[model samples]
Target chain A: MESVLDIKQLTMDFGGLRALDHIDLDVKAGEIAALIGPNGAGKTTFFNCVTGIYKPTEGDMFICPPGKKRERINGLKPNQVTEKGMARTFQNIRLFQNMTVLENVMMGRHCRMRAGIPGAILRNRATREEEQRVVEESYAILKKIGLAEFVNEFAKNLPYGAQRRLEIARAMATEPFLLLLDEPAAGMNNQETKELDELILRIRSEEKISILLIEHDMKLVMSLSDRIFVMDYGRKIAQGTPEEIKNNPAVIKAYLGEDIDA
Target chain B: MNTIKELKKSFLIALWFMFLTFPIMVIKVNTVEQTIDWRWNRLAMVGIFSFFASWIWRYLLQRKEMGQKRAEESETPTLTFQQRVLQNPKFTRPALVVICIFAAIFPFYFSMYQVNIMTTALIYVILGLGLNIVVGLAGLLDLGYVAFYAVGAYSYALLNVHFGMGFWACLPIGAGLAMLFGIVLGFPVLRLRGDYLAIVTLGFGEIIRLILENWNEFSFGPSGIANIPRPGFFGIKMSIHQSLIYIYFIMVAMVIFTIFVVRRLQDSRIGRAWIALREDEVACQATGIDKTKTKLSAFALGATWAGMGGVVFAAKTTFINPASFTIWESIMILCIVVLGGMGSIVGVIFGAGILILLPEYLRAFSEYRMLMFAAALVLMMVFRPHGIISAVRRTYQFEGSPEKKASS
Candidate 1:
C-alpha cells in the first residue's frame, strides 16, 4: 500500500522541552491509523507539527496523494499545508462560533474556490454558479454528517457531539487526501464514540481518505485503526497492529506501569 | 415586595447620581461676574431624571436577562422587529419605495441648511459603511481609518490644484491612493491583533494628521488648500442651491452603490473568509484562508470607501484641511459603525444619521450636546453591545436533496 503521509525522524523542540522527539510515522493510503499515548505525550504537538502550526526542528515530512507524486511539505504555512491536501481538527473544537454550520462548512471550500473581489461584487454568472455549487456541496457534506437539521444554526448553538462531528465534516470539506483528527472522541459519550467509530470507518472506505487520529478512547481506536503507533515522553515507543499494541510490553509499561517481573 | 425593592434600589441610585453631579449640575460659576449661583431647581431636576432613568435601566436589564434565557430555551430564537422588517418583502418593498421617494424630494422640501446637514449625515453613512468592512465584518479595530479619509481628500485637493483634475477623475484616484495607504499600513501591523492593533492604528492616524499639519511644502501646512472645484455637471454651470442638490443626489447615488457592493461582498466567499478570520485566526488559516490576503484585502477595501467619502466631503465643503481629519473624526466614524450595528448596512445608516444629525439638531442645547452623545453611547453599550442591528448571517436555503432527485 502507498503511504499517504510519511514522516521520517520528526523532532520538535520548545526551548529545552522536547515536545516531539524523532518520531517516525506514516499513514498508508485509505488506512485509518491511530496515534495513542497518555496525557501530555505530545500527540497534539505531533498533529500541530504535521499540520504546519508548528515547524518541526528536524525531519522530512512528505505527502503523496493517491496516484500522485510525493511532495515534500516541510516549513509550509498552515493554509499552505491545507492547500496541499492535508486537513486537521483541533482537540478543542474551533468552529467559527458566530457563523452558521453551513457557513462553517462553506469556509472549508475557500481554498478550492476561485472567486475574488470583482467576482464577489459583480456576482457574474460563473461566480453565482460557483457559489451555488459550493452551497450544495457543503449541504451535501452536512447531510452526510447528519448535521443537516442544524445547517442554518450557529456553530456554537449546536450540541457538543454535533460540534465534534461538524469539525470532521469541516475537515472533509477541505477535500484532503490525509485527514488528521486530534481527540475527536473527547468529551463524547459512548453513543457518540460509537458513531464516531462508524464515521471514521465510513470516511476511510467511502471517501478513500487516509485518517490519522489521536484518540484516548482505546476501544474505538483499537477497533477502528488498522495500525497503531504508541508515544511516551516525546518518543515513539511502539508501532504495530491493534492486537500487537494491546499486548506490547513497552506500550503497556508506558500506559499502565512497568512489569514487576522485569 | 419585588417592586418595592426595585424602587428602593432606584432611589439609592438616584441619590448617588445627584451627589456625583452636585458641583457640575447644581452649582454654576459666574466667572465673568465672579459670583457663585446655587441652582436648587437644577438639583431637583437631576434627582427626578436620575430616579426614572435608574428604574428604566434596571427594567431593561431584567428584560435582557429574560430574553437571553428564553433564547436558550427555544430552538429558533424569535426574530427582532428590525429583522422582521428587513426579512419580510411585505414590509421591505413598500418601505424601500417610501424611503427612495423621501430621499429624492428631501432637498426641495427642506431648507438648504437642512439639506446640508443631511448631506453631512450621508457622508458619515458612507464612512461608517466603509469602516464597517474592516472593523465590523473583518473584526479589525482600525483607529486610523480617517487617515484614509484624509488621503482621499488631499489626493483630490492636491491633484486639482496642481493639475486641474476633475472630481469624477479624482474619485477613483483618491480611493486607489487610500487603498495603497491601507496596504502600506497593513503590512507592518499585520502581526498585531486587538488592543495592540488599535494602538498602532491610533498612532498611524495621528501620524497622518501631523504629517499634513507640518508638511508646509506639500499640503500648504495647517492653513490648508482652498477653492477645490466641486463635481461638474457636463460643463454646465448652476446656482449654489442647484449645485447643493446635485451634490446631495450624487451622495445618494454613491450611498446606493456602496450598499449594493457591501451587501454583495458580505455574502461572498471572501466575506466569509473575513468573518471566519475574525472568529478564529488559527482555524481560519487551517481551513485554508490566506490570513495575509484576507487582512490586507479588508484594509484595502475598507480604505477604498473612506477615500471616496473624503473626496465627496472636500467637494461638499469646498475645503480641505488637516483639522478635518483628526483622531476625533476617526473616533466619530468608529462610533457610527459601532452605534449602528457593526456589520448591518441599515444599522450603519441609522447610526450615522443619529450620531451626525443629532448633535447638529441639538445645537439649541449645544451645552449638553456632548453630554447627551456620551450618555447615549453608554446606554447603547449597556443595552446593545452588538449595536442597533447585529449582523445577521446569510442563510442559504437548502433545496430538495440529491437523493430525492434520483427517486423522482
Candidate 2:
C-alpha cells in the first residue's frame, strides 16, 4: 500500500526542550496508524506538526490523497493543511461548544464551500443550493456517527462519548484523505471505547480514509491499529505490526519497567 | 429563625448603604449662608427604601440560583419564558406584525419631536445590529467601533463639502470607506485577542477622533461642519416638520433593509464560520476556516454598517463634529449590543429603543438620567448577565431530517 502521509526527520523545539526530535511517521492509505507514548512523549507534538499548527524546527512532510499527486506541505497554515485533504481533532475534544451538532459538522465543510459575503447577504440560488447540500451532507455524517438524534442539540450539551464521535464526524465533513485524531478515546467508558473501535474500522473500510491517532488506551490501540509506532521521549523507539510491538523489548521497557532479574 | 436571619442581613445592608450615602443624603451645607443643614428626613427615607430593596434583591438572587440549579439538574432543560415566547411562531409572528404596524403609523400619530426621537432610536437599532456582527457573533471586543462611525460620518461630510455629493450618494461611499478602515484596523490587530484587541480598537477610535479634532484645516477643527443638507426628496421643497418625518421614514426603510440583510447573513456559512471562530480559534482553523480572513471580514463587514449609520446620522443631524464621535458613542453602541443580548436581533432592537428612547422621554428627570441608566445596567448585569434576551443558535431544518426539527 502506498503511504498517504510521509514525515521525514520531524523536529520540534520549545525553548530549551526538544519536544519532537528526529521523528519519522508514515500512514498508509486506508490503514489505521497509532502513535502511542508515555505521558510527555511528544505524540501530540507530532500530530501538530503534521497538521501545521506548529512549524517544525526542521522537517519535510508530504501527503498523497487517494488518486492525487503527493505534495510537500511545509509552512502551510493549519487551515491550509486541512484544505489540502488533512483534517485533525484536538486532544481535549474542542467542539464549538455553542454551535449545534449539525452546525458544528457544517463548519467542517467551510473550506470546501465557496459562499462569500455577497453571496451570503444576497442568498443567490447557488448559495442556497450549496447551503442545502451542506446541511444534508453534515446530517449524513452525524447519522453515521450515531449523533443524528442530537443533531440540533448544542455540541456542549451532548454526553462525553457523543462529543468525541461528533468531533470525528466534524473532521470527516472536511472530506480529508487523512484524519488525525488526538486521543479520541481518552475519556470514554469501555462500552464507548468498543463502539469507537468499531467506528474507526468502519471509517477506514467504508470511507477509504486513513487515520493517525494518539491514544493512551492500550487495548484499543493494540486492537485497532494496522501498524503501531511507539515513541519514548521524542524518538520513534519502535514501529512494526501489533504482534511485533507487543513482544518488542524496547516497547515493553518504554511502556512498563525493565525486569530486575534480567 | 430564618426570617430573623434574613431580616438581620437586610438591616445590615441598609445600614451599610446609609453609611455610604451619609454625606450625599444626610448632610447639606449652604455655601451662600455658610450654614450646615442636616436632613434627617432624607436619611430616614433612604434607610427605609434600602431596607426593603435589599429584601427583594436577596429574594431575586436566591430565585436565580435555584433556577440555575434546576436547569443543570434536569435531563432536558426547560426553556425560559422569553425563549418560549421567541421560539413560538404563533406568538412571534403576530407580535412582529403588530410592531410593524405601530412603527409604520407612529410618526403620523405623534409629534415631529417624538418622530425625531424615534428616528434616533432607529439609528441606534441599526448601529447595535452592526456592532452585533463583531462583538456579538464574531466575539471581537471593539471598544473603538465609533471610529468606524466617525469614518462614515466624515466620509459623507467631507465628500458633501468638497465634491457636493448628496446623502443618497454618500451613503454607500461612507460605508465603503468605513469598510476600508475596518480592514486597515483589522490588519495590525490580527494577532490580538480579548482585552488586547479591545485596547487596540479603542486606540484606533481615539486616533480617528484626535485626527479630526487637531486637523483644523481638514475637518474644520472643533467648531465642526454645520448646515450640511438633509437628504433630498426629488427636488421638492419641504418644511422642517415634513423633512423630519421624511428622515424618520428614510431611517425606517434603512433599518428594515439592514435587518433583512443581517438576518439572512446570520445563518449563512460565513456566519457559521464567525461563530466557530468565536468559540475556539484553534479548532476553527483545524476545521478548515481561515482565521485571518474570517476576522478581517468580520471587522470590515461590521464597519460597513457603522459607516452607513454614520452617513444617515450626518444627513439627519445636518452637522458633524469630532466630539460627537467620541469614545462615549462607541461605548453606548457597545452597551446596546451587550444589554440587548449579543447576536440576537430582537434583543438589540429592544435594547436600542429602551436605551435611546427612555432617555429622550425622561428629559423631565434629566438630572437622574445617567443615574437611572447606570442603575438599570447594574441591575441587568446582576440579574441577567446574558442581556435581556440571550442569543439562540440557529437550527437547520430539512425535509429529510431524521427526527423532529429543533426550533430556536
Candidate 3:
C-alpha cells in the first residue's frame, strides 16, 4: 500500500522541553490510522508538527497526494500544508465562530477558488459562477454532515457534537487526500460517538480519503482504526492491528492499568 | 421601588454632569475686554435641567427594557405591521430611491457653507468605510490610518507641483502610492496582534507626519502646498458656487462608488476570508487561507479608499499640509467606524453623519464641543457598545430552495 503521509525521526522542542521525540509514523492511502497515547504523549504536538503549525526541531515529513509526487513539506506554513492536500481539525473545535456553518465550509474552499479584488469588486460572469458553485458545494457538504438544517446558524451556536461534526465538514470541504482529526469524538455522548463512528467510516468509503485521528475513546479506536500506533512519552510504543494493540503489554503499561479491552 | 432606584441613578448622573460642567459652563468669556465673568445663574439652570433630564431618561429606558422583556417572554417571533412594511422590498427599495434622489438634489438647495460642510461629512464617510475594511472586517486595530490619507494628499500635491499632473491623472497615482505605504507598514507588523499592532501603526503614522514636517524641500516645511488645482468642468473655469456644486456631485459619486465596491467585496470570497481571519487566524491558515496575503489585501484595499479621499480633499481645500493629517483625524475616523458599528456600511455612513454634523451644529459651544463629544462617546460605549448600527452577520444560502430538495 502506498503511504499518503511519511514522517521519520520527528523531534520537536520548546526550548529545553522536548514535546515530540524521534517519532516515526505513516498512514497509507485510504487507511484510517489511529495515534493513541496517554496524556502528555505528544500526539497533538506531532499533528502540529506535520501540519506546519510548528517547525520540528529535527525530522523529515513528506506528503504524497494520491497520484501526485511525494513532496518534502518540512517548514511549509499551515496553509501551504493544506494546499499540498492535507487538512486538519483542532482539538478545541476552532471553527470560524462568528461565521455561519456554510461560511466556515466555504472558507475551507478558499485555496481552491481564485478571485482577486478586481474580480470580487466587478462581480464578473466568471466570479459569479465560481461563487455560486462554492455555495452549492458548501451546502452539499453541510447536508452530508447532517448540518444542513443549521447551515445559516453561527458555528458557535451549534451543540457540542454538531460543532465537532461541523469541524469535520469544514475540513472535508478542503478536499484533502489525508484528513487529520484531533479528538473528533471528544466530549461526545454515546449516541453522538456512534454517529461519529459511522460518519468517519462513511467519509473513508465515500470520500476515499485517509484519516489520522488522535482519540482517547478506546471503543471508537478499536472499531474504526484499521491500524493503531500507541505512543508514550513522545515515542511510539507499539504498532499493530486493533486486536494486537488490545493485548500489547507495552500499551497496557503505558496506559497505567486502564485495560485496552475494557 | 423602581421610581426610587431611578431617582438615585438620576441624582448620581446629575452630580457627575455638574462636576463636569461647573467650571467650563459657568465661566463666561468677555471677548471685547478679555475679562472673565462667573455666571452662577447659568450653572444652576444647567444643573436643574440636567437633573430632570436624567430622571426622565432613566424612567423611559427602564420602561423600554421592561417592554422588551415582555415581548421576549411571549416568543411569538412575529413582526409588527410597521416592521413588516419596513422589511418589504416594495417599500424599502422605493425608500432607497427617494433617499438617493434627495441626496442628489440636496446641494442645489443648500448654501455654499452648507455644501462645504456636507462635502466634509462625505469625505469622512469615505474615510470611515476605508478604515472599516481594516479594523472592522479584518479585526486589525489601526490607529494610524490617517497616514494613508496624508500619503494620498501628499502624492497628489507633489505630482501636481512637480510633474504638473491633472486631478484625474493624480487620483490613481495617489491611491497607488498610499496602497504601497499600507503594504510597507503592514509587512513588519504582520506578526503583531491587538494592542501591539495598534502601537506599531500609531508609530508609523507619527513617523509619516514627522517626515512631512521635517522634509522641508519636498513637503514645503509646514507652509504646505497652496493653490493646488481644483477639478474643472469640461475645460472651463466655473464660479465658486458652481465649483461647490461640482465638488459636491463628485463627492457623491465617489461615495456611491465606494459603497458599491465595499458591498460587493463583503459578499465575495475575499470578504469571507477576512472575516475568517478576524475570527480565528490559525483556523484560517489551517483552512488554507494565506494570512499574509489576506492581511496585506485588507491593508492595501483600505488604504486605496483613504488615498482617493485625500486626493479629493486636496483638490477641494486646494491646500496640503501635514497638520491636516493629524492623529486626531485618524481617531475621528476610528470613532466613526466604532460608533457606527464595525463592518456595517450603513452604520458607518450614519455614524459619520452624526459625528460630523453634531460638531458643526454645536459650533456655538465650540469650547465644550470635544468635551461633550467625549462624554457622549463614553455614554454610547456604556449603553450601546456594539455601535449605533451593529452589523448583522449576513449568510448566503444556495438558490432555489435547497431545504425543500433535501427534505424531499
What are the DockQ scores of the candidates, in order?
0.64, 0.71, 0.58
Ranking by DockQ: 2, 1, 3
Q: Give per-residue CA lDDT, model 2, range A1-262, as digits (tens).
A: 8999999999999998999989988999989999998999999989888888899999899998889899999999999999999989888989999999999999999999999989998999999999999999998898898877787788998899999999999999999999999999998999999999999999989998999999999999999999999999999999999999999999999888888888
lDDT measured at residue A86 in model 3 versus the true structure, 0 to 100: 96
Tens-digit lDDT track of model 3 for A221-241: 999999999989988999999
Off by over 4 Å in 1: A259-262, B11-50, B400-408
CA error at residue B144 for candidate 2, angstroms: 0.9
What fraction of the reference interface contacts is present in each model, in order?
A: 0.82, 0.84, 0.77
DockQ of 3: 0.58
lDDT of each: 0.93, 0.92, 0.90
Q: CA shift at B314, candidate 3, in angstroms?
A: 0.6
lDDT of 1: 0.93
Per-residue lDDT tens digits of candidate 2, residues B21-73? Answer: 99999899999999999999988888899999999989999999999999878
**Could you tell me which residue pairs clash in candidate 2?**
none
- Position B28, candidate 2: lDDT: 93
TM-score of 2: 0.95
